[model samples]
Target: MPNIEQFTPTEAYEALREDETAALVDVRSRAEWTFVGLPDLAELGRDTILAEWRQFPGMTPNPSFLDDMTRQMGGTTPQTVLFICRSGARSQDAAIAVSQLMEEAGTPIRCINVAEGFEGDLDGSGKRGGLNGWKAANLPWKQS
Candidate 1:
């Protein structure tokens, strides 16, 4: 089995609501977050952590990703962390990396890839956010 698990946006939202130790991490670039909007976790009394798995423009991997995650998580280490991006791919990579890191730290966590992500897959018109994502599912979200 892979180090990470996969869940649809609705499933992830439910898990986050049910599990107090569950948290979310958005791995899209800052530009994407600003332009495409962000997941709203305020209802859960939490805020989604923002960290780039890959930087904008060049799309280069962010060297400080793990560090940023650790810092953003602070003293409270969540038992479950859901990772989301524009689509599922990048979030999966982020989930795997974090899973490995947490296991190595002797604090194994359930790292989940929000499979459909915030924007989901492309539509017939070659666009996203309308098929099967967090936004499409009508989950809480907002623009920056």
Candidate 2:
């Protein structure tokens, strides 16, 4: 069993750059993607940008998150799938869930949680995403 890893947005980006099969999975709410934006992986033309959540603006864990993710990947190959969420919490949970699901299915997928998510740290006043994540790494993202 391969160990699951936690990746910085920068490291995740580098993985995408080097591996054609590598994929970034944004597990955040639809609102997060719309409002805060996402990493621009124009290089991976066929790589998927998908949401495991069916709703918007909330942080509740989707019961079907693993199933949705399995559907998104389309198979049980041990592909490098990086999970990202609002902060790092949800993504970490998502990663663990996916890993466990894959293990049970005998697919043995490689999952990484993107530490700090899209909008990472809070500002001095307890704001979010001002310190870490894809935006903090200075990655390319489109604002909504």
lDDT of 2 by residue, 5-58 (tens): 988988888877788787788887777677778777775564545665535545
Q: If scored against the real structure, what TM-score would every candidate get?
A: 0.95, 0.84
Candidate 2 displacement at residue 81 in angstroms: 0.8
The alpha-carbon lDDT assigned to residue 126 of candidate 2 equals 92
Give me the candidate number with maximum lDDT: 1
Model 1, residue pairs in steric clash: none
Scored against the true structure, residue 134 in model 1 reaches a CA lDDT of 97
Task: Count clashes in each candidate, considering only residues at least 3 apart in sequence or on different chains.
Answer: 0, 3
What is the C-alpha local distance difference test score of candidate 2? 0.74
TM value for model 1: 0.95
lDDT of each: 0.91, 0.74
